[model samples]
Target: MSACNAIASPVLDPKGPIAAAQTQLLLDAVAIMMIVIVPVFIMAALFTWRYRGTNRNARYAPNLAYYWPVEILIWGVPAGIIFWLGLHLWSATHRLDPYKPIDPEVPPLRVEAVAQDWKWLFIYPEQDIAVVNELVFPAGRPLALRITSDTVMNSFMIPGLGGQIYAMAGMQTRLHLLADEPGEFWGRNVQYSGRGFADQQFRAIATTTEGEFGAWVEKVKASTQMLDATTYEQLAKPSVKVPVTYYSGVQPGLFDSIIAKWHGDGNHLHAQVTGTEQAR
Candidate 1:
């Protein structure tokens, strides 16, 4: 997509609540920085013309040194801007924390993500189904992702939904996102792993229509393919630009086993954190 176009930037054209807030923050940052940038550029032009050697009428103050007003304008203004920006950043960091649930009252849809060499595996535990390079969830609900890498480290991001989290072998990362309505948002691995990294992408579908999510799940369940240990072994092999695949069944505890395979202790820390969140 042409990011330079007004509507081409996924970040700027947010379809989710978190992305919308991030967009606002970006615009605000630009406006605040322009407070100094615009005037500085304009003053630079005026100063260059006024102090030119050809301009004899211009006042030449060779010995005139410091002006407290100008010093305050440059130093104090930036200081204030930095202080304000810092506060905003601090608040946002906590407010948009990926671990925190969007609405504590609403139960989040859990999706386990496994990052491989050149593709993504999304497993819906509650639904007992899995898909390759496609993530589907009900819209207007919070999505809680448990992500890890089976190969090299990778970064997961959905620009239109905001936030970026890394997936590392033997470690699980958390990210919570919510879509405001039905739409297909782009999801990809931003980290560079190999030649196939360019094709490490997926489609995130948010279903707004009633029964849509259920119908999609049913469709996946109707697929003949099954995800067993042997099946997963072959599926994990490195490949590029893999077409979407659906599995009617998933081996129980498959997600945990993948973590244990890499990290001897398993995702004990993440499990503990998840337990604590549930209690609250």
Candidate 2:
């Protein structure tokens, strides 16, 4: 498919360097495997046609037990492919580690992501604003996401930006991504939690310039709505296809609080909050 039609398969339609690298790696792996697969299928068809019962003149070597050249060809080719694949996979795993920050020269924008029931909550701690079922960030800037779930396990993914990571109640996962250019992409929960799983999707907007992102934040901040413990409790309840909503004032350390609440003991919860309170 053309890049213009990338919205249909976000994984194939990468908008950032990290995602573009991943897409290339995927294509390389498929191409390498097809090298062996295509030949094997073609040889199978040729052998079937040449040795068919109707072809009485076909050579038959029933006693062929140990042919060094044939044995080498059969085993060496697969081993070579496997070795090449292993090397690429190892390199990609380390280079694309989700925890590894991107573009150290450019400080990453921190965003706290919480997966609740059938919706997504994105809190911009630095900006002191929050939005539900919508995320906005500036293009050409690195994004560092700290993700967790308040309910059952879920996967936070933006196929056009980078890979997917799991989010569990009480456990926070990190993901780093960036947008090479301005565009809108799709984000969704890949893991099935309940009846509303299919509707658990959001829009990721990447603005062209820092000024545009700042303006968007200001617009959200102008909203009179507030997101606090009480409001969060209501939002946490199971819901489907929720409309995009913005909150002007967000409670401090709200993301950490949600993760802490899942811990069994009060002391652990307190410790978790204390350790993360100063974190942006």
Candidate 3:
């Protein structure tokens, strides 16, 4: 499972600002921990060799239970490490908050994400378009995602872009991410929901050229399929390994309506979406 997790998440190869920052924090933590680990390993090897039968002169401290120096070395050092690590984590947690806007100076592209039983749905509210199993945005631009699950709980992640954020039924989550360059990244569901969970994957395309994303959006908009409440009900049915599907148009407030289904209070999300849309 550990090896499978490593293979599934390509977090080491960070392609975006958030992922890069997270990778650096991981490296820093490991480096700090090695300060104690390396010394403990060296001392263990030395003690083993010195106490061997071949070395009869080795000192015996069988009656020894407490030594202040050793006590300080063990407890004090670890306590200090804990203190340092806590400070580091406290600072990083806020800076790398998933909900925090990556670049406030630049208006972010808003994308609504819905995790279904066996596939992912990405709705571009501003563009009035939606796609399944594919997410597209411009490179070097901030992307703000509003996520919720239409089925069971799922974790939405693009490992090279940022950390995973949970998408739960009835509740919305926010994740802000940015890609530094044009490339294709894999996005997947980290939580196991059912048999189709393994095939719940998507492609996240980052376009770099000016207007390249617009052109791609235009291409998607040309698709004949339209996603309305009826179409969505049919699409919501469980299916495995669905291909990349695009809907040129979507029913207005469809994403909000899905969230409203669980709460039975349709106006709350509607009002929130309206305020944010107006603010943006």
Candidate 4:
């Protein structure tokens, strides 16, 4: 999408009220900071001109110690600004903590996510399906995602949404998001993992209806190879800028296995190979 169009989309159709509120709050904070920053910059320039030694009219007070009131203006003002900022930030962060549930009336759809070397794997336990390198969901439905990483730490982020959540090995994190409209959005592995760090990104396709979403699942399942235990072992290997792929059937609870292995389980010997496969 054009940059102008992308900018307009988020405003015109925010994922939900919470996201819209966040965007507004961000813009407001920027404006407030600018009020102080702009004046400080202007004064800096003015001081350079007004205090020029070449101008004999300029008074130079060599014995000048800071006046108490002037010191108060310098410290108190910034402290107050910081206090205000801290209050707003603290409240907003807790209110929008990714793990917190939304209103009871609007239940969220749950999806489990895993970040591995060079790719993302999303599992819809409710739908009994999975996808790699692509995310699809019904637009307007609240989505609550439980995320983790198979090996290294990664971050789940989509700019048009809100704050990102970190996915670390053997640990689960949560993120709640929704696309207000039907279209494609991009999500990335914001943190560097290995060779593919620069291009470890994927598309999120939001559908208008549940039927459309089901059709998508069927299509993906029909078009891909069956991902069994062996294939998954190959997939988990590290690599760079790997292209996207869809798997019709992945080994049962593969993500769980990865998490277990990372946590020091001995069930899978494959997981024991550490740095050797870092390049895959």
For each candidate, what TM-score against the reference? 0.90, 0.91, 0.91, 0.83
**Residue 237: error of model 2 in Å?**
0.9
What TM-score, to 2 decimals, does candidate 3 have? 0.91
- In model 3, the runs with Cα more than 4 Å from the true position are 1-9, 265-280
Clashing pairs in 2: none
Q: What is candidate 1's lDDT per residue for 1-280, written digit by digit as tens?
A: 1233223327888888889988998898888999999999999999999999999999888997998998999899999999989999889889988888889899989999999979999999999999999999989889999999999999999888877899998789999999988887788899999999988988888998649999999999999998876688789899998999999988777787777777555455345434544665
Off by over 4 Å in 4: 1-19, 250-252, 266-280
Better candidate by TM-score, 1 or 2: 2
What is residue 63's positional error in candidate 3, in angstroms?
Answer: 1.1
- Per-residue lDDT, model 2, residue 253, is 76
Q: In candidate 3, what are the lDDT values of residues 1-280, reduced to their tens digit?
A: 1345345448888999999999999999999999899998999999999998899898898999899998998899999999999999999999999989998899999999999989999999899999999899999989999999999999999999999999998989999999999988888999999999988988888998649999999999999998876588789889998899999987778887788878876455445545555665
Clashes in each model (backbone N, CA, C under 3 Å)?
0, 0, 0, 2
Kindly provide the TM-score of model 2 when superposed on the true structure, using C-alpha atoms. Answer: 0.91
Tens digits of per-residue lDDT for model 2, 1-280: 1244336437887889888999999999999999899999999999999999899999899998999998998999999999999999999999999999998898999999999889999999999999999999999999999999999999998899988999999999999999988988888999999999988988899999999999999999999998876687789889998999999978777898888788766455445544654454
lDDT values for all models: 0.86, 0.89, 0.89, 0.75
